[model samples]
Target: MRVHLGSDHAGLDLKNHLVAWLSEHGYEPVDHGPFVYDALDDYPVFCLRAAEGVAKARAAGGDDLGVVIGGSGNGEQMAANKVEGIRCALVWSEDTAKLAREHNDAQMVSVGGRMHSLEDMTRFVELFLAEPFSGDERHVRRIGQLDHYDRTRELPPLPESAIGLGPDA
Candidate 1:
């Protein structure tokens, strides 16, 4: 798998470590980076490129994924999701990492550099890369709703139980 990576100064060390780890683990890692650290560097600049790389590679039928890193990973996740057709998940644990791929079919993962130890984050990424989407009917349906909304800006109707409820009810 091709893994695209990006990060701000806060995550530069972790991102750099991941690049070497990924290569040793037999995955192609693409670095969309600051190259040299600048304290004022923006996450969006690099994260968007990583997300775009995954989106373009997937569109071309390649099995590609992305990782974006920052101090809290929140902004990086938001930036990644702004790219069309990109499902970026903010992963903080093993379960979240697995669920991001299995349930949401996320192509990109965001990690908080300041939140965990190197080993913990590395394990999370490993779990994310190893998991596969479930492709269950419910998951597919939900994902379809999201994709439709992304394309059309149309909201899915409320569930039947909520249809007749008043605002106060």
Candidate 2:
């Protein structure tokens, strides 16, 4: 599989390390930016582009994914998710990393470099790559609803039990 990667200055080293690591682990790595660190660099540009690369690859029938990194990863994930068709998840733990893919079908993973040690980062990425989406009906349905909402700007209908007045009213 091909993986696209991007990061701000804070995550540049990690992104570089992962590029080599990913290639050694038998995946093609696409470095999206920060060829040379720019202290004033913005995260969204690279993150969005990386996510776009993955989305475009999928549209072309390629099995590509993306990883975005930053000091906190929160902004990067949010920006990546703004791109249509990109499901970017902020991953802090191995379980959450794997679950992002398994439950949300996330095509992009955002990691906070300041929050974890190198070993844990490696473990989290490995777990994320190893897991497969369960594709359970409810998960699929909910993701579909999110997609519908994204397109239609409509709120999900409330559950039946939540739609009525209280009995004591």
TM-scores for all predictions: 0.97, 0.95
At residue 34, give the lDDT of candidate 1.
67
**lDDT tens digits, residue span 1-169, model 1:** 9999999999999999999999999999999996998999999999999999999999999999999999999999999999999999999999999999999999999999999999999999999999999999999999999999999999898888887697724
- lDDT against the true structure, each candidate: 0.96, 0.89
Q: Put down candidate 2 lDDT per residue, 1-169, tens digits, no spaces.
A: 9999989998898899899999999999999987788889999889888989999999999989889999989999998999998998999998899999899989889999898987788778878887888999999999999999999999787777776756522
Model 2: weakest 10-residue lDDT segment is: 160-169
Best-performing candidate as measured by TM-score: 1
TM-score of 2: 0.95
